[model samples]
Target: MLNASNPSADTGITPARRTTMLAVLMMIYTVNFVDRTILATLGQAIKLDLLITDAQLGLLQGLAFAAFYTTLGIPLARLSERVNRVSLIAICLAVWSGMTALCGAAQNFVQLFLCRIGVGIGEAGCSPPAHSLISDMYAPRKRATALAIYSFGIPLGTMVGAVSGGWLVEHFNWRVALVVVGLPGIALALVFRLLAREPVRGAMDAAATTVATEAPPSIRETIAHLFGNRAFLHITIGATLVGFVGYGTGTFAYAYFIRMFHMGYAELGLVYGLVGGLSAGLGTLLGGWMSDWAGKRRRSWYALLPAIGLLIAAPTYIVAFTRGEWITAMWWMLLPGLFHYAYIGPTLGVMHNLALPRMRATATALFFVVVNLVGLGIGPYATGALIDYAANRRFSASGLGDFATQCPGGVAAPGAADSLQSACTGAMAQGTQDGIVIMLLVFLWAALHYLIAARHMGWLKREAVASPAPARQPG
Candidate 1:
């Protein structure tokens, strides 16, 4: 057994092994999201089948999953700080994958919601441990790029989920699609178990490579350390806000296209997979590369790049939503989809820099707590509630008879004087569109926070120059 006081550092991993490890991890992440996001494409069908409201759907997509996912992350991350991270990741993969398959058998809303919760429990185990391992494998200069490559799984998963799940749904049904996406991860878990070798904690940190792994930080110690860093706190907030709007709008985007443009599942999948996925994936990679490139000149550019990207994203998103035509809207949507993802690499890169080597996983968990609970937990649910509220208000003003009884989809706006079908259609389209539009503008708020973080980072860099720290990477 490895001694607690003299832990072994990972040594002699070949270039091939490093590349293989990264590839496998990325594949696992892709599978992770494939299960997580397939539900997004299935919304229109699920709504019709269950006769549920948007608010309830929002709960399924957001709070039900995010609550447990975020809440469980800290303890799991704390465990990872000591345990074999490879084994931990494998177990998590199986748990979430199995739960995702179980989602297919759900006959009702409650059953499906419970299954989603289970999947969340599994997914929470993924990124924190993986981030810690990757940081150990790569030096400071290359860490951001590596993490960004890992992040490609997100957009890649979105694309695959949208396409494959959508294709399955178009050909067969949503339930079948759910089972298909969920089962593969179980096998992939075994593959990762066989292949990945855990690295020494802090091996990639300058000069810290020689030190043995220290005792894991306590939760209080971890939190205190994180909160003490102003730049990390601000960047965390910016990431949270990004997730809020990003997840909120994403949860309902397919539904919007369905209601407004009458696009079918296959077409929606095509647009999201080909356009949104590729653009977002490329943008994530570009952000990491650019963060490293510009950050070489001035370290503060890490946060500065994200600020500029979010500002650009905010306006383009508004333009995308407000467009009347779907083709025109998709063209506009492409830009935001690409640029909006700029935060992932830098935000995470900064957090790793801020925390101690032993605290990387814990710090990652904390980041997720904010992003998942505050952002994912509330963003989609709040937006859904907004749609519900706006639609009801519109329906009430229209003086329509009970909307639930008359409308096919049973959504109505109070202010519209149209017939039942017209009322439902108009209300659904207008309410969802407006709710998303409002959420899109929140990017401006996130951008402001990133700017604040950049200022704090600048000051920190100056202090470090005055007295250098081992953790500080060379510019």
Candidate 2:
């Protein structure tokens, strides 16, 4: 057993082993996101085939998946506090991967919705435990960068999903796309289980801390402790708002390109994959590296960096959405993600820093609940509803009887007149564009919250210094 008294003793894990572990964890996360995002890449095809409304698609993308994913996260996280986190992650990996493959078989909205829920339930077990493990391996000063590297999985997976899902859907079908992406994860899960070694919890904390000896806090206690901190509350709120805009816009971006630009699946997929991947990957890393670099001088930089990034992202996003041409829009798209994603790493780092070592997983679970529920659950659905409403209003103005009946899946019915088809296409393109612009405006609100959180930086600094004290035992 590693001595708790020595902060330098990190369970005899060599630097190479640590790198390999982080790499595997990141790969697992990449797989997690690829399964989650493949649906988005194939959304237009699925919409056309199922003849579902935008709202239905939103539910499939957001609420259906997020409902169980967020709800189950706390319990799974609590379980991680007791069991082997690597084993838990492996099981979840298999479950979600299998569910994702099953999604390829769904012929209707309800069936696909259920499969997405299964994917969510499995994904719920991923990040909280992973965060705890990473925190234990890396010291406080390096946690943000490490977590940000882990978060690189988000963009990496998105890139792979877009590129691969697009090609698969084009060459075969959406069903094949899902199955192809989903099956590989089972093998990856087995590899993760065999390779990852559990680290001693809190081994990197100050010598006075008792996290290795103390029992994990109850859910109620963890919630109470986290909510009691003003900075955590603000960070959660800011992150939730950002997630709202990000998920909402992201869910429909490919659909918008298809409707408005008339780009084929494979072509648009490659473009979106490269653009989103590079920008977001850079942004995630910069957020962590910049925060850590600036945070050394002033702890408030953590919150301030995200605020600054969001403020810049909002206007650029507006410009990107408003562009009439796809080429110009893609160019503008690159700028915003570089700034918009800066919040992810810093927000996670601060939340972990504020909690006791044993409370870390629970804290992550709680934070995810709020962020994913509101952001992932409602963001896409709300945006889709907005697009539907706007499209219907425009269609009605053109003397169309009802948008839904006249235009199923945002296109005119078969054998419809060219005039009606043209109207349907115009209404959909404009509606989607308008909805995305409105959602982008939410970034400003999110940035404001981050600015407010910066005001409580002293509180975060104090918590870090005071973390060496023993945690209160559950009664």
Candidate 3:
């Protein structure tokens, strides 16, 4: 547990060093997300080429990457506690980058899936160690803000992946885009290895003065400590639910635009990349800043802001998913993007506060396991499967049941895709819209958890003061 009074906050940190390190880490994280999520941007191309179902696409997006990532996350997180975190991150970055490039050359679904798994295996080392490093550099008060800044990588990566991926797919191909995006990370990893220095663990805490030689808790103990907190558990549930809805919806958002609004890939990339990415980035920063500011006044506000944000996002997303025109629909998405991402910085910040400093990596690793395993593992596939079901159902209901054999959506002839484009455009949009609209409702579910976490904040804080150690034992 944090000392709550961080006397070490004033030591070992210069503004210049802090800013540079955060920026570098953010760049690394950005690259990681780009590699992880670039697949979604290429959904149409991959789907058509592979001739696979949406569920299979979801499997590639969610399970293939997340299975290895969530599984290896804990042990690698355990390793981060004792090893040079910088080296671990660098090595992981290189491996994932290389594997991401390999995704370009995959000759079949199995090969691509395996390559995604390899990317996941390498990426497993990223967040926990990065979180540990960030916690060490920033004080408790500034932690959320710092972490939020670091998390900017998510939106940035999404931006690059969307725009560049769209361009690559349009001008060249998906394979070239993958290789192009990936090769840069290898060089960046080497640069990170050469330039970044590891901060002394827990240097931002009062306890840093005395525990220089203390060993971090065993992995079992670390997990026990983090999971022992009821508030932490509630927050984890909220975050997991958020990831579930976010990934599920986002994985298909590009395709939705293409199918719903008849947007070209170039337009889809630029519009979504700029509008969605920028809005999400702002929302992420705002969420972190809001939590930090409000938490200083009332700790519960950390979760409260996100809860409010999620509630606001639900309606916005519902509207976004329902509408057909790209112009009006994107306007609805701005607020949803902002509100949807608000939970990330604060939730992770709270988890860091919940555990002992030395266990920060382990704690974050555990958090990712629940969030990723449930969210990433299931969200996209669920949405994809629903799309398939709903599309088939809508096709059948439209009195085009006979044509279902030729076209899955019954909106096209087998060889004349553009021939019936105008007649059944609405039917084409129905399935994906329904799929997204259903998932958007899940924001309300996640919001409820955030609310519950806030309700327990006072009690949890008091308990933290009373005996942080007892919280380390599984209740």
TM-score of each: 0.92, 0.95, 0.93
For model 1, how does the per-residue alpha-carbon lDDT over 1-475 read when each residue is reduced to its tens digit?
Answer: 0012222334346668879999999999999878877778898788788778888888888888899999999999999998988999999999999998899898888999999999999999999999998877876666678899999899999889999977889999989999989999999999999988877677656446444546777889888777666666787788999999988888888888888898889888888677889889989999988886666667777888889999999899889888999999988878987789988887777667656778888889988998989788898888888887776666666677555555545444355445766877777788888889889889999989888877866733633111112222347
Candidate of highest lDDT: 2
Q: What is the C-alpha lDDT profile of model 3 across 1-475, one tens digit per residue?
A: 4576564454455768778878999999999999999999998788777766678889999999999999999999989988999999999999999999999998778999999999999999999999998988887777888899999999999999999999999999889999999999999999888878878777777767654577888878876777677667778899999999988988998989988887878778988899888899999998888887777767777777889999999998898777757898888877788988989888877887666778889888889999999899899999998887777777666564533454643345455656344434555567888998898899999999888877767622523231112233335
Scored by CA lDDT, what does every candidate get? 0.81, 0.87, 0.83
What candidate 2 gets wrong by more than 4 Å, as runs, is 1-7, 458-475
What is every candidate's alpha-carbon RMSD to the true fold?
4.7, 3.6, 2.9
lDDT of 2 at 32: 90
- Which 10 consecutive positions of candidate 3 have the poorest summed lDDT? 462-471
Residue 162 alpha-carbon offset, candidate 1, angstroms: 0.7
User: lDDT, candidate 1, residue 133?
Assistant: 85
Off by over 4 Å in 1: 1-12, 207-213, 402-405, 408-418, 459-475
Residue pairs with backbone overlap in model 1? 394-413, 394-414, 394-415, 395-413, 395-414, 396-414, 397-414, 398-414
Error at 294, model 3, angstroms: 1.0
Q: Rank the candidates by TM-score, best first.
A: 2, 3, 1
Clashing pairs in 2: none
Output the better candidate (1/3) by TM-score. Answer: 3
Relative to the unseen true structure, what is the C-alpha lDDT of residue 203 in candidate 3, on a scale of 0 to 100? 76
